[model samples]
Structures are given as structure tokens and as C-alpha cells.
Target: MAEQTTEQTCPQCGLDMPVDAGYPVWCTGCEWNVAPELFVYGLGGTAARRRELAGRHSEGTFEELAREGTRGRRARLTASYVLSYALALMVHGLSFALLGAGVGLLVAGGGNPVAWAVGVPLVLLFLVLLPRFPRLGSRVPRLERADAPRLFGLIDEVAGEVGTRGVDVIVVDGRVNAGVHTYGLRQRVLHLGLGLWAVLTPQQKVALLGHELGHFAGGDTRHGSVVGSALYTLRLWVEVLRPERWNGRVARVLVALPLTPPHHAAQSVLSLLEKVSLRGFPRREYLADDLAAEVASTEGARDLMETLLHAARIDDELHRLAADLSGPHETLWAQLADRVAAVPPRERERLRRVSALEWHQQDATHPPTHLRVELLDRRGPSTPKVVLDRRTEKAVERELRPSARRLARTIAQER
Candidate 1:
């Protein structure tokens, strides 16, 4: 039986509010305890400051987008955007210069021992750094058109509705997330994680597809080649420049003396790119959510957001099952499905309240879940552009079964 909700008086407002039992008590009138002072553990110094800046930037973006609406005119030529792109071009240019110099050294110093010694290392360095550029594609299990026609057809229908081209490839994995990314000269790949997909309703799955495809339609610059490649390069530079830990204090200081300045410089540029990209990402995410609402109906999109609230719980259960040596390997997904379905309403509401208090979002780039859900509520109901029927949904599930079993067994054995 479902638990009954009871009325409780708010201390500040003295208003009787209906709240589910065994959940956080907060006032609807005064909004008490909604954002209680959190006892955060490991936030201080540089990390704390970055967190503060990210939160402030994301919140500002949410408010601005919410006020102006997702369809509001977007200014593409902001100072931050220009500066970020300029830095990206500069980074790429420097990399090319290094590459050219390395090759030139090898060509000019043909057989000289000293020259070969110097040239070989430079050439090797270039080769070492080359893989980070234009990074594309993962090694996950790929699903071909013939393998799942219904699924691909559904994706095509969504792409049509969203005004984008269909994906070139679809890959399934064990992660509890899904995304769309470009690889190999703009070939789009859609990644579907069975951990999340298997439990979603058919319409929720449509919403997921709409949201991912919407990233393409929205022209997400952060994920685009220029900024994306630059971000990766800067990250690699940071890792390369980081000072090594030494046993002796003098040795550590010596290593730091040479590497610290360049390391800090690279980090500053990385932070700048991240800050600029953060400005664009929240708006793009909200726009994607808007597209998701359009394609899957407001109710479907809203429900999907609500489902995200329980993601941590789902992840925790997956980890617990993974760590259990005696757990049945064959029934991994089935056990997860049952556990998810058994999450009580009170716990769901508790998760919602926790999200509000923590200002939880999918990531730093995403707006808070509460804000996104509210934006959807403000947009009101939308008629779905596409719907997933039960038969087609079942067909897709059956098509995914082989990979699902393989992934499940892998997870089970990894313990």
C-alpha cells in the first residue's frame, strides 16, 4: 500500500503544507530548508573557488535563459567566445609549429649523431602528443543498421523531427548515461547505456533520443572541433607539465621550479576556456531540453528529468551488485530493473528535495534539475512529435539483448 501524506505546519509561515512522510520538511511559503547550509567535506582553496565560480555562472545562465526564454536571440560574438576561440587557434598553431620544427630537425640533421639524438626525441614527443588531437570513437559494442532496424528507424524519425541528419553509428555500453558525439569528419555516433535505457519508459527513451539529437541541432560549440580539441590539448599539457613527486624536499622543489610556471599557465588557459564554455553550455542544454519537450511531449520530458533524480541511487546499486561475489551474474539487469521499479514514492521525493538543496544538475554544464523542470512546467504541455509504440520498443530491446548479456557478464566478472 502507498503511504499517506500528512499536513504539517510551517514554523515560519504557519501554513499547513501537505508533505509525504519520511521526507525532508520544508515550507512551500517561505522555502525553508530547501537550501539548508550543507556540511560539504572536501571543498577549499582553488577547488572551492572554481566550484563557486561554476555555480554562480550556471545559476546566472539559468536565470537569464528562464527569464528571456530558450527561443530568445543568442549572441554568438561575445568577448569570451571570441577570446576562447582565439586561444584555441593559438594552441593549435603552436602545436603545428612544434610538429614542423620536429620534422625539420630530423630532415636537416640527416646522419649527425647529436642531431639524430635531439631530432629523435622531438619526433617521438610529437608522436606521443598526436593521439589527443581529433579524438574520436570508443571501443564499445557497435550496433549496425541490420542489427536493429527499428531502433535506427526511430532515431531517423527523431532526427527528422529535430531537423538534423541521422546518426552514422550506434554503440551500446554498460554506463548509466547516453550521449551523441561527432567523430571522423562529423560522423555522428549515438551512445546508449543499457543501465539507464533498460529501465526507461518508451516515451522517456524518445525524450533521451530527442535530447541527445538536440545537441546537434543547437550547435553546441563546446563539443565542436575547435574548442573541444583545444580543451583536450590544454588538459594534456597540464598532465605533461605537472611536477613529479620526489622523495627529497630539495628534489621536489627543483622539479617544481622548472615545471610550476608553465603548468600554472596551461591551467589558467584551461580555466578560461572552461569558463567561457560554461557560459554557452547551460543555454544549449536548456535549448536541448526544450527540443526534448517538443519531441516527447512536456510530460514525457518532465518525467525524464524526474528520473534523473534517482541516478545516484541506481549507480550505487549497480556498484554494490558489481562488488558482490556471490550475486547472480545472469540476472544483473533484471535485478537492477526490479530494484529501480521498487523505489518508493517517499524516497523519490526525498531525492527531489536533496537535489534542490544541493542544486543538483547532470553536470556543471547543465542547469539545476529543479530549474529545468520548472522551465518545462512554464512551457506547459506540448503534443509529442513522435511516439514509440510497444511493439517497436520491444523489437529494439530484443535487438539489444546480445550486447546486454555480454556487458552484464563482464560487469559481474570484474569484481
Candidate 2:
């Protein structure tokens, strides 16, 4: 195979490594890889056939279905955001407004202290009628840009490819998932699961990053925050006066009256709204998948989705590793790659086929891996040319090594 040339530079040590198409592209000095570069099996080769098969067993690729879903989601999201802020501001406004009226009435009453009676309702309204909203935070361990320049460098490049500003904070966590979190109006946080990263090929890793960054360009996280804040406020109001959590918690009898019929009604409405609000999420997920493919390649996207299909197996293996091995998180993690590699090619192929069997669940933000893969398969052929070395992988690993170890130990104790 002829070597593929890349305009890409090494994120760790900037160096140009250009080559002809067909082979993996490697750095001259550090040998850092540029993932998924060469052309390979792609939508151009398999889409029509796959779609034909999909139609026999699935709803088929209905463009109108996606369009309708997108339209519905936009309308709901706009209404939700407007209602959230409007209700929040209205409550605050009423609080101040009632306080103002109460003060005016008290002063007018003058020497007659009984005049304060006119302001009693207003005072009560000011203190008890308003809803309090909690500020959501990342709440995960953060990796600073200075400490992980190389990782951030690749991330920044991927963001550029996905047309995003990149996440403000990068957190390393235990879940085998990567996601973006935004607080209030802004403050985007990206969480990368160490377990997930440990298993991905260099090309698949790029696709994974692209998938996370794609959320920013897609504005899915922003939509989520609006719905989440609204639900949170309603939930808090509903729970505030519950009898069960009192005394041992905060004394429920004193607050029982505060949990009014109206609060209960709002809670019920929010519960229904929570399921209805994210209706378009599955479609947005497909769009993000598309963006990842666009930024990486069809092959990269396919590989990334394949990685998801193997998540259950990986998790089970990790659990077994924890139970069987008495070692730190890093040690368990170091063997993670080997465990994945040990999965026989025939079994992996069986998994790839099984991935297509996942059905879409109601209220799920993401469709099953099978459906996601089918959609991605439609994008034209693209593949990575080069892969990073173990040294480079270890360098990225060090960023979350401590956390991975801690989590591993925790898993062992839990077992």
C-alpha cells in the first residue's frame, strides 16, 4: 500500500510528515499517528445495499422522519427555554414586587402598627412562593490545559474540524462514555471516560473526540440544559415539603403546607414534560454521528460505533479483571487494551453483526448502536492512515492515571 500524505502536524511535537495515499501516515521524529486517513470500505461501496436490507427489517431510511423530529424538537426547545427563564424571572419579580408593596403599605400605616397587617400576604409571598434553581456543575475531576497540552492540542484540532470552540473544561471520569456538559448559558465541560479511551484505536479515538466535540456544534447540550433546569426547579419545589424527608432530614411537618396543590401539579407536569421534551434527541445524536464522520471519516465513525457495541463486553471484562487481579487502577487499565485485543476476530465479527439488533427505546436520547452504524455507513469511504505509538498513548494515559487507579480500587472493594 502506498503511504498517504497528511497536512496534519504532531500535537505533541510539531513536525510535518507527508506521504502518498494508501498507507498509514507516521511522524518522522516522534512517530505520532494521524488517524483514519486512507480510503477504505465506505458508504459509497455499501450504503444502497445496507439500506435495502435495513428497509426489510427496519422503518427504512425515511428522511422525512428525521426532518419532522428536528422540527418538533426545535419548537419544544424554544418554548421550554422561554418558559424556563420567564417563570424564573417572574417568580423573582413577584418576590421583589410583593416586598415593595408590603413596605409601601407599612409606611403608609404610620403610627398604626396594625397597618402592617395589609402587608402580611405580600411578605409571605416574597419568602415562600418563589422557586429556587440549583446551579449544575461538572462535579468531576478536571484536567488542566497546561498539564495536557498534547491532548488539548489534538482536541483543539478536532474542534476546528467539527467547527466548535472546544470545551472549556476536560474531565476524566470512570464511565465508559464521553459527553459534554454546559452550565447556565455557557461554560462547556467535556468528560472523557478513561476506560473508553484505553480501548480505542488511534483512528477510533479521533472519531470519539469528534463525536464529543460534535455536541457543541450541534447545540444538543444547550437544549438539554434548558429542559434539565426546568425539571430540576419543579422537582425541588415538589420535594421541598415532602413529609418523608423531614426531621431526620429537615422536619417535614413545619414545611408540609409549603408543598401545596399547585406545587404537586407542577411536579406532575414536569415529569411528563421530561419524557416529551427530548423527543428529538435521537435525531440530534445521528447528526453528531454525521459530524464525527465528517471530521474523522466513514471508517472512523464505523469503528467508533463498533467500540460502543463492545462496551458491555468490555465492562464485564473490566469487572472480572478487578475481581481477579489485586492491582492498582492503572494496572487493570493497562491490561484493558490487551483484553480487548484478545477478543478473537471471529467473536468481534459476531458482535459487529449483533450490534444491528438494538432497537430504539422510548425516552432514550440516543438510538441503538446498530441504527447509528447504519446511518454512518451512508457517508462515503474514509479511513485512517497512521496510528499513535504506545509511548504517545501512555503520555495521554498519565493525565487520568491516578483517577483510573482510584476508580479501579473502588470497584474492587465494591465487589
Candidate 3:
């Protein structure tokens, strides 16, 4: 139940605001008593300015897309898409050029010491600068079709509904998140976090799968090799250009001075590529949400979004559970579900408002959670095409228990 609100005077604006006993009280007119302690420290000079610029860009993008009203923008090759692709290609091209230069020098100047000196470093640098493919770490528990037919069948059903192929690998982990990505010649992999999965109802689970698989179906460019590889290469270049920490101020200056220009350049290019690539990202996300609604029903999709609001709390509980060595390992998931369910209605309201006020996002690439939810509300209700019944959920749960148990033991041991 919601706590009773009392009128309180805002210190900055003297405006009357309704104050909930344990929730933040703020003035709407002057925006007083907002999240004052949320600012990042040491982000003073250029860093501060860059963050502001990015914020402006995000605000503008959100407004523009929201105004456009979710028309048929899925997988449409806009000008921004074209430009982003070109930039990515250029980044890859540079790496190729560097490799060619080194090879040419070595081939032409056979026995020269200078050729060997320069060429070897150039070749080694090319190897270091290459774009990396994401792989499932050995520690993660992987589920196969034979091992979990019910789960795989559900995945395939959802995939069909979303108009995308099912994932080649399903890996369960301890995070409060789920994602799908391609690696190693377009092999699709899905990561299911038991922390989040444990708390979701069957319909919400369908919604979650729909949203992730929909990314592939909607042609999210960030998941594509061209832009994805470019982003990866740029990050590597930035890391390569950054100087390591040195003892003295003088030593630091000396080490940093020469690397500063190139480091800044790489960062600027990275920012540009990201800005361009992300122009249509919000639209793609909305499209995925649409797919989610189509497959799982609008109510289910909304419920899934609501559950995401409790993610931070879920993460905290997961950590605490992992740290409690004396606690029964088998009850970890049940304990998590119980704790999450126990969050008060007032707190849930607070979280919803906080998300709206903060423009809470899942990541840098995603639109604000509030915006996504609002868009869903605007679209109205949907009839589900697929459902996860109790029997199927039970079978799937049974298949997942061994993996979940192993993960729990690992977490406890590591802690």
C-alpha cells in the first residue's frame, strides 16, 4: 500500500510538494531536492562537457523518435545507417592498410635490420588491433538441445514468432540480465541470467525471449559484424594508445604526452561511430518490444519491464546470497524470489518514479526504460501468439536445475 503523503515546502522554490514518508520530496517547478548525489566525480573539464553533449544528443534522439511515433522504421537503411557502415569499414580498412604496409616492407627489404625492426612491430600491432569475437567463457554452464528439449522447443517457438532463428547456444549465468549476440561466423548465443529468470512468471519469460530474439529479427546494427567489429577495433585502439600509470608527475607527463593526441583522436572517432550507429537504436528497441508484445501479449511485456525496475535489488540479493557461505546452497534461487517478492508496493512506486526521473536505461545503447514503457502503453493491448504453460515451465525448470545448482555451488565456493 502507498504511504500517506503530507504537504511540505520545498527549500529552493518554496513550492508545496507532497512528501511520502520514506521517499524523496522534490519541487516540480524548480526541480529542487532531486538526485543531488548522483553526479560522477572527477568529470570536471572536457569529460563533463562531453557527458553534457552526449546527454543532449540522447534527449534529442528520444524526442525525435518518440515524436515520429513508431512507424515502420524497423531495419530501414537510413542515411545514418549508411554513414555508420562507412565509418566501420574505414576503421577496418585502416587496420588492413597497416598490415599491408608492414608486409610490403618485409617483402621488399629482405635482409635489412631496419625492415625487420619496423615490420615486426607493425605486424604485431596489427595482430593486437584485430577485432575480437565474443566467446562463452569456459566457466559458464552451456545447455544443449538434447539436454533441454523443452527449453529449446520453447526457444524455437519464440524464435519463430519473432521471425529469427533460435540460438545455437544457451548459457546460464548468475547475472540479473539476459542478452543475445552473434560470435564466430554468425553463431547465435543467448545468455540467460538465473537471477532474473528465477523471478519471472512464465508469460514474462516468453516476453523476455521475444525481446531478445527480436533484436536479431529487427536487424539491430550494433549486433551486426560491420558496426560491431568497428566498435571493438576502436576500443582496442583506445586501449593501445592509453599510457600506463607512471610513478612521478614528470614520468607520467612524459609517458602521456605523446599518446594523448592519438588517444583523443581514437576516442573522438569511437564517439562519432557510436553516435551515428545509435541514431536508430531506440527505434530498433521499440520494434523488439513490439515483437515481445506480439509473442507474449502486451500485459506480459509490460510485466517484464516492471520486473526490470527491480534489477538493482535483485543484483544486491544475488551478491548477498553468494556471500552467505553458511546458507543452504539449494535454496539460493528460492530465497532470491522470496526477497524480490517481498519488496513493498511503496518501494515499487518509488522505483517507477525514479526510473522516469532518471531516464533509467539498461545500457548506453538502450533508450530510457520509462520511454519504452510509455511507448508500449501508447500502443495499447495485444493478444499473445505464444504462451508458457505450467507443464512446459516445470519441464524447463527441471532441465535448468542441474545448471543452476552448479552455478550456485560455484558462486558459494568463489565467495
lDDT by residue (tens digit), candidate 1, 312-374 = 777777767767736545467777777777665655665666565566788777878887888
Query: lDDT (0-100) at residue 142 of candidate 3?
Result: 88
lDDT of 3 by residue, 1-415 (tens): 3355678898767888776565566655665655444532222354345445544544565576577755344667788889999999888887777799899889998999999899987788789776666556776668878989999999999999888889888988888999988766587888999999998988899999999999999887777767877887798889888866345688778767777887898899999999898887767777788788889988999888989988987988787887874666757888888777766564565566566656678887777777778777866788888989999999998999998888788777876
Error of 2 at 301 (Å): 1.5
Model 2 alpha-carbon drift over 4 Å, by segment:
1-140, 221-225, 246-258, 326-328, 358-363, 383-392
- Per-model TM-score versus the true fold: 0.76, 0.68, 0.77
lDDT of 2 by residue, 1-415 (tens): 2224355666657886564443344444653442222221222334345445542312432254333432112222455445545554543565478788987887787867676776766677557645444354556567778768767877888888777777666877666777776655556667787678878887788788887777767666334455445555567656653455545434444454545555666666666565444544565667777767766777887888877767766788778887888645568877877878765443444455434432322125666667677666655575542244577666777766777778788777767
Clash counts per candidate, in order, are 0, 13, 0
Ranking by TM-score: 3, 1, 2
Looking at model 3, the pairs that clash are none
Answer with 1 or 3, whichever has the higher lDDT: 3
- The 0-to-1 C-alpha lDDT of every candidate, in the order given, reads 0.75, 0.62, 0.79
Cα lDDT for residue 289, candidate 2? 75
Error of 2 at 193 (Å): 1.8
Best by lDDT: 3
TM-score of 1: 0.76
